[model samples]
Target: MSNNLKKNAISLPGAIAMSIAIMAPAAGMMFVPQVVAQYAGSSVPLVYFIALIGSLFVANTIVQFAKRITHAGSFFAYNSAGLGQTMGFLSGWLLMSGYFVFYPQNILVASFFSSQIITQHLGINIHWSLFSIFFIVIIWYLSTRGISSSMKADLYFVGAEMLIILIVVFAIVLQGGADGHTFEVMTAKGSPSGWSGIFFGMIFAMMTFMGFESAATVAEETSDPKKNIPRAIWGSVVGMGLFYIIVTYSMSIGFGSQNGDEFAKSILAMDYLASTYVGDWLRIAVAIAGIVSAFAISLALNNAAVRVIYTMGREKVFPSKLGITHKKYATPVHAINAVGILTTIIALLMGFIFGPYPVGYGMLGSFGTLPILLLYVLASISLIMFIRKNHRDEFSLWSHGIAPIIGALVMLLPIYGSIFPFPSWPYNLVLTLVLVYILVGFILGLVLKRKTQNLVQDVNKIISSDGSEKL
Candidate 1:
């Protein structure tokens, strides 16, 4: 590696902002609540509750590694430290795939919301592809600037999104809800589809927690990384968890139990709720929040994907040029550009081949979910192994062992649900495609291990570095 990222460029709040942005609480409320309600019925809150618990366990497992091994590679470095170099590379590749897949989905979301807002308010009809390309270009520019700049933008966008959500949530509560709040929504008896539907709903429920671990990816850029990164990871889960539960509950009550079918059928449930409880103006605000949330996540995920590639490149697992940072900005310019261009190409291709809505919003969204859950399982396993073998003196049975095991097991539920039910054409195909991608990565890892002498040592040296070296 010949270039270094700026050290101490991000603070605790900045890191936390990025993590929350990546989670995209506003977007989750919009996209996930209706679908979850369709399956889990009034038990939507409970589904989010279960997902929150799983996210906490996974966050704790990640904290275990973040506090010990501070690296920009995040899951890549953590798995390498806990497992071996090969597994680490595989984890990185899988994690990268997750981000790559999600990038287009975010673009699609931005395009969709932007189109909706313009067509509804401005009375102008524009194709979503134009807005998608515009947003993608904006994301590319922001991400390539530097970590500090990108995260600062994240703070603004995420703060606005959260503010809108909170406004609508409080409005629902103060209005006493359409049917009044009750604990019945938390029980399986309230579910229209019963327990089976609740289990199926868990798959999407867990997906809302997808980017909570994102702070760890910026460990190298954060101030006091060993301390801040762990806090950001755990704080993200707690913050977003509370946000999801409250919004979901308010939505459940606001829409009223009698209107379950209406809530399920509505394309933008939260926006409809906002229009009913607050005002039609709040619908526009929610739409704006959706657009901002999508843009913020795209920026955050791009930042994360590039760092993983930069780390791998540094270790010679990828092209060495990808390891180079911008001389002035100290950002991973090469890797960022590569990811941006590739993401744009994929987004355009998918839009052309399958249309923006189906491919961008549907297929790409499903493509990322399974790999992320798998990565969570692998990271948890790596934590368990690392603690047992290396950090036995400091390890606690709960945080180091039991928590990760529970995390791995809880994550499996979603993975199983995603596959066993065998979703319709495109979604079912995503599972097979993700497996094929990982298989290819595993083969590549094996080849790299055989060809690159001292590959493990290089990875170790890079992860263990103190930010003074190029790494």
Candidate 2:
């Protein structure tokens, strides 16, 4: 094994695919809109639009940073360039936590939805845990096949995943929907609780866009990363942003916008819309595709998590063993296994504790979301500091200053929702657990204060001495 990841192995499309697949478009649309519908009512589309704006604010900061720093530890490196070793390590630590928790969500979701299809079509009884184990093994194997294999797998899966969902969404528009198309569904007036309710729904709406940053993690491995990584980041955010808005509006009207309560209450909104607007065959097809979408997500996230962990390993932030790559595959072998292994352990634990349907998915997904939101807040601050310190002459009042400030403030909405007027049990447990996890990292940072210079030096040497693209 060698301590190197294959450079220039990924192209622009591969990077774009990585960012989009991690969003799990099909799985996200299938699951999240209904949750948003609960408060936004028929205004689900409006809520998503607002969330898209918030995402853009964060995206701008990431894009600006990507133009200058290209490294495998995407966010970590960006933060390090601006914030120094301690804050940078903490940024990576929170992001790594988010990814580790995010991976098992796909295992649980894939098993939950696939289980429905299997029991309905084949008349076989199988526990979701069995399906969970099946998926865990498949993800581990696919990940080990190396970066090229994983990126190719996601391209096909995300394409097919987008196709089936779009067909159904467009079909609803053509049919003039269940209530003959009303503009009311797209208005703030559509919400049951007015603007406040819309704000609340924005919590889940923002969560759906969680994985858009997956592209940034592969900067070191991608060709023309300075250009490609920023483009990939914008491509995912804009592409998925529009996709989320249109599809949600279609579902709202398809369910007779006034029936938002019923829409939110459905077990699987996509399956319901498919069976109603098209046919049962379409529902079955979506179910099958949903499984593929979930797998694509699992695969994409595993690829990203490995790089983050690999970067940390190389810098001695974590065990050195995790820094090694396979000689043939040129993939971070130990990092890949660590991601898969942690996912496997969590899948069984959460599945047994909560059952893999609505409860398990909610608990895990929310747990994953809280930290990343905080990470973005910190990263936005890092952008300003990075620009002012390293590229002082180029810093702008807006781009490096005002924009990152707005981005940080925008991200605080969801972080606020996660706490104060606290979420109930389980979710409360997640909040508590995440706080303790971060606290532990903070304590570790203090303990290693003297060694921080070494940490930053190792992180810096990972990037070659070549000049960066100008801001």
Q: Go through the candidates in order and give each one's C-alpha lDDT.
A: 0.83, 0.84
* Tens digit per residue, CA lDDT, model 1, 165-260: 889999999987888878877878667878877878888887789998989888888988889998899889998899899998888888776666
Q: List the residue pairs that clash in candidate 1.
A: none
Residue 398, candidate 2: C-alpha displacement in angstroms: 1.9
List runs of model 2 lying over 4 Å from the truth: 458-471
Off by over 4 Å in 1: 450-455, 458-471
Compute the lDDT of residue 276 as modeled in candidate 1.
89
lDDT of 2 by residue, 1-471 (tens): 988778888999999999999888898899889999888888999998888888888999999978877778878778877788777778888889878887888889898877877788899888888888887787778778778778988999999989999989988999988888888888887788898778778778877798888898888789888899999999999999999999999999999878888888887898988988888889878887888998899888888888999988877778889989989888888998888778889988988889987788888888788788888998999999877876788889998989889988878876776686787887889889888988987777666555556656654553334545311
How close to the true structure is residue 456 of candidate 2, measured as C-alpha lDDT?
60
Question: Worst ten-residue run, lDDT, model 1?
Answer: 462-471
* Best by the lDDT measure: 2
